[model samples]
Target: DESIDIPYFGELNGIQLVNPIWVKAVPYNVKVVGANNNVVTHLRLWSTEPSKKQLVQDEKYLKMVSKISESLYPDDSTDEGKILRLQQQYLFSSAGIQDAIREHKALGRDIKDLPKYYTFQINDTHPTLIIPELMRILMDEEYMGYDEAWSIVTQVAAYTNHTILAEALEKWNIELFKRLLPRIYQIVEEMDRRFRLFLKGKNLSQDKINHMALIGSHDVRMAHICIYGSFSVNGVAALHTNILKEIELNDFYQIYPEKFNNKTNGVTHRRWLMHINPELVNILDKTVKGNWRKDLSAIKELENFKDDESIQKEIKNMKLAKKRQLIDVIYKDTGVKLDENAIFDIQIKRLHEYKRQSLNIFHVIYLYLRLKKDANFRKTFHPQNFIFGAKAAPSYIMAKYIIEIINRAAQIINNDPETKDLLKVVFVQNYNVTYAEYLFPAADLSEQISTASKEASGTGNMKFMVNGAITIGTMDGANVEIVEYAGIENEIIFGLSAEEVTQAYKANSYNPRKIFDNDKRIQDVFKFIKSLDKDEHYFDFVFNNLLNVDYFFVLADFDAYVEAQSRANKLYQDEKTWWRMSIMNIANAGFFSSDRTIKQYNEEIWHLDTIKL
Candidate 1:
């Protein structure tokens, strides 16, 4: 198995050294057992088993293993680690470009014709080094001139930005960039120079030109490189695209207004709807006309079924079935049993402060406090199960702290005799793609509570919509579009709009501390967080974060969020209306199909004709 014959390409002198290459599949979850782990020992044994002529090829691999063991780390948070990541990017991109050229050569096509055959859309700035790498291949390897290489490279590449978070924007220090990639850096430097001259020719201000430059004061902005090298630059959603034009990438937008565009993010309904909710798919297949699978717009026909009692009841039954499946999983994983009758209010995404998992937890705490304070409200209140699933990035201290508090709150509330059955709390561990298939459909309410203007676009919101879960969300990201599709009365929309949030920041008029002091309900929530018995140390930071730095405006939107929840609860009491709203969500979600998105991309951006199977 290790001596499997494969196509070989030698880097040195372009001659094959080995007739066959030894390839091995390594498990990611291999046990660490001192010096001889399973992977290491297995590889070591395979290499030492001798060759046909009894030549020892083992030493070469042993040396490689030793070097890898010494250089590689468990924690990729250091300068060396950062450099390693850059090295990986360069290696992957360079190799991929080389392969593409090899394929072009096999077809007997001129290298300049590469643009007609291939267009690489760089999703985010991760693979942006490929632009310069391709240029280097053309100019250096193929002996093409700089102008010719630049033209071909520009035609073959496009970029899509997914986030406006400053930290998420990729930038490499000039020293590290030049040291690691001397040739690519040279090409980038020339590109930056040409861009600056082009801006000067347009009579643009030097300040604005500097802001839009590929290379900044001490670093090379990867996004700027992407924008400069690519034929087009796009954002993931409409609002996100507008914000990119007006705010984040404003300088670039001004210079190349024609290059900027919007492609609102979409999810594959085949995965989110057809596969995940097969029962609902079966019902739709029976009731809805035409092939809705191929033509998602046909899902709009389900709007007529909204008023039908039988269909509404069937939808409710489907949700209950999903809840039963999820409850079994929760119990198996976390040993926490959830009530089937309780409202399954779910918030699941990556743990980030802006996404506002903390706000959800705070509202849960407020409800707990209310139950403890008022007997009549406790008796009358709807039984609710607040479910959460998230994973914090290892380096993000605040996100990890947020997870800890959520778990801490869950532990306290779920154990309390008074609140255990009345209000359950569960935070599912290691939430992933496999889990989402089960999670989205079972939800009574979907939480899309990211701060207004902060979220790029949430496909999870769309997935939930297709699965018939009503969103209680801010008018941000695709949620604005979702509200429009579902009707404003259906999806709970409560928050400052993007313009209002931006204006508040411009005026420097917003203060979280004032809200904390002024609002009793918010004050009580903060007080409870401070007074929590478990994780007392973390509570101080959480308290400080709110009073001193509520960057996501959790306290600012707290009242509106709570009022929305109250409204949701009241509406849930009217089962007929709630199911009708859920049906509306399912009907409107047809527009969110990735088939439509890809069709748009093919027509507008990629300009490629579809090939029928």
Candidate 2:
């Protein structure tokens, strides 16, 4: 504890000071229980600790150091917050790298052999700094040459690209980076110089080389550094990987085609299935006896029982019970009573324009309008409850606006007697892992309707799929693979294909205004949204975004989404068919298990030898 001394940035006498900041390594024992036994793994959490002398004399230093471990992903709305975020990233990377090297040296292994024994998987752009940090240790600390350290660093690290959004790929301003981390910035600058020389040797055009450069005019591209420094680069889903190669990171792919690969995302059935939905687990136990918990592939046997009436009845009853559980929670939390018998259509993810929470709510408005005006339509329609759970980032204005609109819409629809019985909207407050445990099992229709090629791969989609929720989604992210596994007919798939969405963006041919003008239903929904816009401008942002600059194609996909919703409602009316489809979804979800994902990673990327306990 407090064993690592890191050079930290501060200001004294109106001048920058690079002083030693002591850090503590807090250890946690994580027990992984197996069938016969359990293994203990140590997780080291790094925390900043001021020296005893500094603690008594320098309150500013104490405050500065304490901020590092106080919270995660702090509000980066101010300059202070932005610097703290970068500091947090570097703290984690530097401390972890130092610890790893120390452990290897303690084991009497040569520093050059680090790659043979260990590998670092950079989850996303957040940890890309690990590349430079590792290089710094190898070259500066171990006194290795530039070529030797670069070779070892590349061999030891791999990157996983999690987003197609350019903003998600982090870029730090060069001045701020150098100020916060002077030595690390020097290493990064050197890395950039060598990489530029390497790129030029390949006979690349100046424009292309500049585009791929790690350091741009004003900032350092973290993702570009990750790609250049890592041995392998992967995407989380099949479509996501293809997008990375053919479009997003095409230049990098052109240079190193062998580096690109796909490892589709997955969820643990132990948690999503067995742990959450015990009733469904019991039904599976009775119908198909196998070690499905240990081996999710055994769940595929449930396909044979899809047509069994007794099995279907058990599944239906289990789903109804889960819905009732969710209804109670909704009533307790929001004072909103829901019809447990109504189709439980749920969309719960981070609130974002690209994720299309607006599209989902717009459909709700359309349905509300239809229920009020058309008696004949109301007579034929089935009752449904729309549930949404999400939290927007503090700095994201539009996302916060979407949240406000959803809550306001929930207030209006849930209070009105005319549509209250047939249609109910509930936005669960403070949604998190606990809320998801309740939502996933209760969902009858899972909404995975992100815009095509926008979502990388949604683990929530996998969670819902395994819990027997039929998906109503666009062909994006893991929804593509989910449809392949669960059978396309079972899912109500809609909207533009990823290729079409990409092409429309490239050609600038698609217009949300055109779609808004062409369709009366979309017009009716927008009118409803406009009606809600008061002095607060709660719905004004939504109206302008959807009509004027719908980058995620919410308006473009509106008609297809509604059609898919109708198809889902019609299928819900047919109980036997719906249950059979639900069973099939559960049966096929075995493919998307975390077991398979990890196995693929170990085989293709990490290649670490297993040690038996």
The best candidate in terms of TM-score:
2
Which sections of candidate 1 miss by over 4 Å? 1-76, 533-535
lDDT of 1 by residue, 336-419 (tens): 999998889999998999999988998999999899889998877889999999987667788877887788788889999987
Residue 356, candidate 1: Cα error in Å is 0.6
Over 170-255, each residue of candidate 2 has an lDDT whose tens digit, in order, gives 99999898878877788898998998999999999988889999999999999999999999999999999999999999999999
Please state the error at residue 93 of candidate 1 in Å: 2.0
The lDDT values for all models are 0.81, 0.87
lDDT of model number 1 = 0.81
TM-score of 1: 0.88
Q: Give TM-scores for every candidate, taking all chains together and pairing residue i with residue i.
A: 0.88, 0.96
Best by lDDT: 2
